[model samples]
Target: MNDDPRRIHCDRHGAQRPAFVCGHLVSGVGLGFVEPEGPQDEDASDEQAAWCDRCETARLAGGGWTAQSEAAAGITLVCAVCFEASRARNTHWMEGVARGWRHTDAR
Candidate 1:
């Protein structure tokens, strides 16, 4: 009977895939949450999550996460897999797909 809320049970991923993300991600409206720069930990988990530029500004407006900023963020809990998917959709990419380049090539 190990009851730890951090170790949540996701309906899709079974159990023990604790993660959290901003409201925009849950709503599928990714807002450019870039990945942390430099070397990453070997764990390879994107569960760190992030906030949009606007939200971040508000959060740090007074040098910290104020009550209003926290409310504006509206953090949401999600499975590890789901978190990864959100990160993929939100993070910026250095390269564009061939299909996207096709338009420039035609002109």
Candidate 2:
């Protein structure tokens, strides 16, 4: 009865024999097991950016990338990889909004 949250022990037939903790299946084979990695540091520069819901990598808005809409309703800043992935996942949309810009209408 292991108490670890990341570790998983399965049976010989890959039937998910049920262990002490929840597990994420790695390969389709039943001869191996895997432990999930820890969360990334939120303050890290690489971590600061979100994985483009479309490309699955960090989005660089100025680096030949564009903003796209997500099926979840709202915009998801994404890269080329994620853009394609998001399209495949059917979880994203395309729309534009102002970011980091100030409006003089308030004055």
Estimate every model's Cα lDDT from 0 to 1: 0.65, 0.28
Cα deviation in Å at residue 61, candidate 1?
2.0
Worst 10 residues of 1 by lDDT: 94-103
Q: Number of clashes in model 1?
A: 0
Tens digits of per-residue lDDT for model 1, 1-107: 42876567777776666676768766564465633456665875655656665676776685756788878878788777877777667654432342252325565
- In TM-score terms, candidate 2 sits at 0.17
TM-score of each model, paired residue for residue:
0.62, 0.17
Residues 52-80, candidate 2, lDDT per residue (tens digit)?
22332212233422354222212323333
Query: What does the lDDT come to for candidate 1?
Result: 0.65
